[model samples]
Structures are given as C-alpha cells and as structure tokens.
Target: MELTVLGTGSAMPVPERVQAGYLLDDGDRSLLVDCGSGVLGRLSGTGTGYEGVSTVLLTHHHLDHVADLMPLLKARWLAGEEHLEVIGPSGTKSLVDGLLDVYEYLDGRVDLAVREVSPARSFSAGGFEVAARETRHSMPCHAYRFSPPGSDRDPTDGPLTLSGDSEAFAGLAAFADGSDVLVHDCAFPDGTDVSNHPTPTALGEVLAGVDVETLLLSHLYPHTGGREREMEESVRTAGFDGEVRVAEDGLRVDI
Candidate 1:
C-alpha cells in the first residue's frame, strides 16, 4: 500500500504546504482521507486527480479538514464520475447536506452518499479494512487504523494508523500501537500554547515506548518552519526514539 501526503498545513495556510489531505492507494483502489483546501488540486499531481477518488474518509468536520469536499464532488461530477461515498464521524451527513444546500447547483449533479461512522466501528472502504477510535480533540474526531486487504492474515503485516487531529494522550497512543506508520497531528512546535492539537514534546511524551515504527508529524502550522529538525529532536528528548519525520506535500511512503 502507498500513502501520499497531499497537504500538511493546518488551518493557518502556508506556501510550503496546503491543508489536511492524504491519498492511500493499494493498486486496485484508492481512498482519500480529508479533502481540505488545496487538496483537490494536489490530487491532480498524484496522477489520480479528482476522478480517481470515489471514497473519502474524514477525521472531522473542521474547515481545515473538509474545505475542499464540495469542490471534489463538483470536479468528479464534471469528470463524469457517477458516485461518491463519504464516511466520517457523526455529523458527516449533515455536513454534506449543508454544503449541497448552499451550493444548490452542485446538488443532484452526482450520486453522492454520506455514511456516518463512530468510534470502535470497523468498516471497509476502497478494499481496505479500517478500525476507528475516538480522539481527544475540541470537536468530535476519530482516528483510523487501516489494513490493506489480506494484511490481516499476514502476521508480519502492520497496519497504518492516522491520528487525524487530536491532543497527545495515552488512549490515542494505544490506538496506534504496533502500527507500521503513524501519521499524527503535531500542529505546533514545543512551547507553543495550544489546545486540541499536540506539540512535538507533548506528542513525544505520549508516544514514548509505543510500538509504532515510524511517526510522521503532520498538520503543521507555519510556525514550524525551520524548526522541523528541532521538533523531531524534541520528540526524541521526550522519549520517543523511533523514526520521526515531518510530512511534506507530495511525499509518498510505501508500506
């Protein structure tokens, strides 16, 4: 399976990054996680384009996380794609309904289906098995653990877990335990007073000694500029000694 980082910036925009979006492709199918601002255009760069994605699994309804959702639908409609399935936390349907309500012209332009998922629910999308867990965020959010098809039967295979947007906590760490890759939201560097999102030090403390092999810090704010290495060192200083890297747009990882 290959995971592509489309956008790594947070709500605060930056030239170096966009908002939250990731594309997980397993050859036969692909799934989009979050369709934030600039994400739709980034999709085109991946050779998948908007037409290549039919399913979107959201982490939450925050503007930074769902800004380009409607644009994606419109793009797919223009591309002659007939169906789209969006899965997310409880308010997913309402979010879609509201967007369609505002953009009346886009309504009925495509076959759109919104499915609401909750924590502890296991579901299949784009030929992958996904496990969900509630996250510690200001609003209701869910972290996801994705396993490629047949990987469940392979003892050596490890799933990829995405922390979405959340604070650093033990429960979230446990949820990502044993993952081959943990793409988490480390929105700020250490010493930046923040809520709902974690700083590098805070994230490191929680992830210390966890079984995750690689931790890719994402959802970055512009403040993190030039401090990328420092952030990684902060996490290590706090006790997480695993491979740590900062996410950038277009970076692809194969697992």
Candidate 2:
C-alpha cells in the first residue's frame, strides 16, 4: 500500500501547506481522506485526479477537513465519473445534503452515496480494511486505521493510522498501537498553548509505549516553521524512540 500526503496545513492556512488531505492507494483503488481546501488541486499532482477517487472517507465536518468535498464531487461529475461514495461520522449525510442543497445545480449530476459510520466500526474501502476510533477533538472526529487485505492475520504487519485532529491521549495512542505509520495531528510545537491538537511533547508522552514504526507529525500550523527539528527532539525527549518525521505536502510513503 502507498500513502500520499496531499495537504499538511491546519485551519489556519500556510502558503507552503494546504489543508487536511491524504491519499491511500492499494494498487487496485484509491481512498481519499479529508478533502480540505487545496486538496482537490493537490490530487491532480498524484496522477489520481478527482475521477480516480470514487470513495472519500472523512474524519469530521470541520471546514479544514471537508472544504473541498463539493468541489471533488463536481469535478468527478464533470469528468463523467458515474458514482461516488462518501463515508464519515454521524453528520456525514447532513453535511452532504446541505452542500447539495446550496449547490443545487450539482444535484443529481452524479451517483452519490453517503454512508454515516460510527466510531469502533470496521469497514472496507479501496480494497483495504479500515478501523475507526473516536478522537478527542472539539467536534465528533474519528481516527482511522487502514490495513491491506490479509494484514489482520499478522498483527505486526504494516498498517497506517491517521489521528485526524485530536489531543494526544492514551486512547488515541493505544488505537494506533501497532500501526506502521501514525500520521498524527501535531499542529503546534512545544510551548504553544493549544487544545484539541497535540504538541510534540504531548504526543510523544502518549506514544512512549506504543509500537508504531514511524510517527509522522502532520496538520502543521505556521508557528511550526523552522522548528521542525526541535519538535522532533521534543517528541524524542518525551520518550518515543521510534522514527519521527514531519509531513510535507506531496510526500509519499510505501508500506
């Protein structure tokens, strides 16, 4: 499986990064997670244009997470793609309905199916098995863990987990306990008063005992600029001794 980071910025936009978006491709199909602003444009760079992504799994309805959703639907429709499936938390249906209601012209332009999934549920998307866990965010957000077809049989096999947007907590760390890559929302650096998103130290503290192969910090804000090394060091000092990486837009990792 290959994972591509589309956008790494948070709600507050930064020129170098976009918003929240990631593409998980399992050769057969592609699954898009969180189509925030600038994400649709970033997809074009992945060789999997909007039409190539038939299913989009969202973490929440926050603007930075779902901003480009309508644009994606319309792009697919314009490209003559027939079907699109959207999966997300409880309010997913309403969110889609509301978008279509406002953009009435795009209604009925494509075969759209929206599924509302609850936390702790497991589902299949893009030929991969996905497990969802609730995140400790201001809104009802969900972190997702993705594993290729039979990886479940081998607990040590590589799987990818995304924290969506949340504070660093034991539950979230445990949920990503065995992932090969945990792309968490380390939105700020140390010494920043923040909530609902983790700082490097806070994230590393919870991840101390987790057995993830790589902790890829993502969802960065402008404040994190020029301090990437410091952030990594803070995480290391807090006790996580695994490989640490800061996400960059368009960076791709194979698992």
Candidate 3:
C-alpha cells in the first residue's frame, strides 16, 4: 500500500504547508482522508485530479479537516463523475446536507453518498477493511485503522493508522499499536500546554511501548516550527525506537 501526504498544516495557515489531507492507494483502490483547505488544489497538482478520489474518510468536522469537501464533490460532479462515497464521524450527514442546502445549485449535480460512522463502526472502503475508535479531542473525533483483508501481518507491516486530532489518548495508543505507519496529530512543540492535540513529548510517551514502523507527525502549526529534530529526539527519549519524522505536503510512503 502507498500513502501520500497531501497536506500537513493545522487550522492556521502556513505558506509552506497546506491543511490536513492524505491519500492511500492500495493498487486496486484509492482513499482520500481529510480534504482540508488547499487539498483539492494539491491533489490536482499531483496528477490525481479531484475525480481520482473514489472515497473520502473524514476524522472530524473541524473546518481544517473538511474545508475542501464541497469543492471536491463539485469538481467531480463537473468532471462527470457522479458516484462518490464519503465516510466520516457523526454529524457528517448534517454537514454535507447543510453544504448542499446552502449551495442549492449543486444539489443534484452528483450522486453523493455520505455515511455517518461512530467510534465503534467498522466497514470497508476502497477494498480495505477499516476500524475506528474514539479519541480525546475537543469535538467528537475518531482515529481510523485500515488493513488489507486476509493479510497475516501486523499493522507495522502493511496496515496503517491515522490519529486524527487527539491529546495522546490512551485508547489511541492501543488502537494504533503495531501499525506500519502512524500519521499522528502533532500540533505543537514540547513544553506547550497541548489541548486536544499532541506535542512531541506527549506523542513519544503515547508510543513508548507500542510497536510501530514509522511515526509521521502531522497537523502542524506555527508553534511547531523549526523543531523537527527536537520533536524526533523527544519521541526517541520516550523509549520508542521506530522512525520518527515530521510530515510534509507531497511526501509519499509505500509499505
């Protein structure tokens, strides 16, 4: 499976980084996760135009995570791709309905399927099995794990986990354990009072005993600026031996 980082910044804007977005392609299918601001444009630049996304997984309802939802749907509709599925946490239906209601012009332009999922929900998307769990975030948020069916491998081998936005929730560590790649929310630097998001040290502590191949810190803010090395070191100091790196827009990883 190959995962592409489409955007890495958080709610606040940063010229160097776009907002939260990720693309997971497992040869037969492609899943787009978190289509935040500027993500549609970034995906366009990657040669995978808006129509390339067959499914979209949203972690939360925050604007930073779903800003481009309408744009993407509109683009696909305009491109003659009428069928699309969007899976997300509760309120997803309401959000989409609200958007469509506000922009009545695009109401019947596309056949959009919006599925609302809870933390306990497990389903299939883009030919991959998916599981979600609740996380400690300001809003009702969920972290998702996607696995290849019938694969006798730990998450650290091929499966992937994405921690949407949490403050190092204990359940999240167990939920993400053994994943090959964990795209975690790291929004601030050390010593910052991390509320609803993880700092470098907090994330390290969360993964101290977990078995993960790589921990990709994402959803960055200006507060996390220029502390990449320090963040990695902090995770290492917490007893995790896995690779730790900050995520950048356009970064791609294959497992």
TM-score for all models, in order of appearance: 0.97, 0.96, 0.94
- After TM-score superposition, the amount by which residue 142's alpha carbon in candidate 3 deviates from its true location, in angstroms, is 0.6
Q: Candidate 1, after superposition: displacement of residue 185 in Å?
A: 0.5
Give Cα-based local distance difference scores for all models: 0.90, 0.90, 0.85
Give one digit per residue, the lDDT tens place, for model 2 in 1-255.
899999999889788899999998877789999999999999988778887999999999999999999999899988999999999999999999999999999999999999988765588766667888899999999998888764554322338899999999998888888888999999999999999999999999999988999989999999999999999999999999899999899999998
lDDT of 1 at 98: 92
Q: What is the TM-score (0 to 1) of candidate 3?
A: 0.94
Cα lDDT tens digits for candidate 3, 189-220 = 98997689988887888788898899999999
Poorest stretch of ten by lDDT in candidate 3: 149-158
lDDT of candidate 3 at residue 11, scale 0 to 100: 91
Q: Which stretches of candidate 1 lie over 4 Å from their true place?
A: 153-158
Q: Order of all candidates by TM-score, from best down to worst?
A: 1, 2, 3
What C-alpha lDDT does candidate 1 achieve relative to the native structure? 0.90
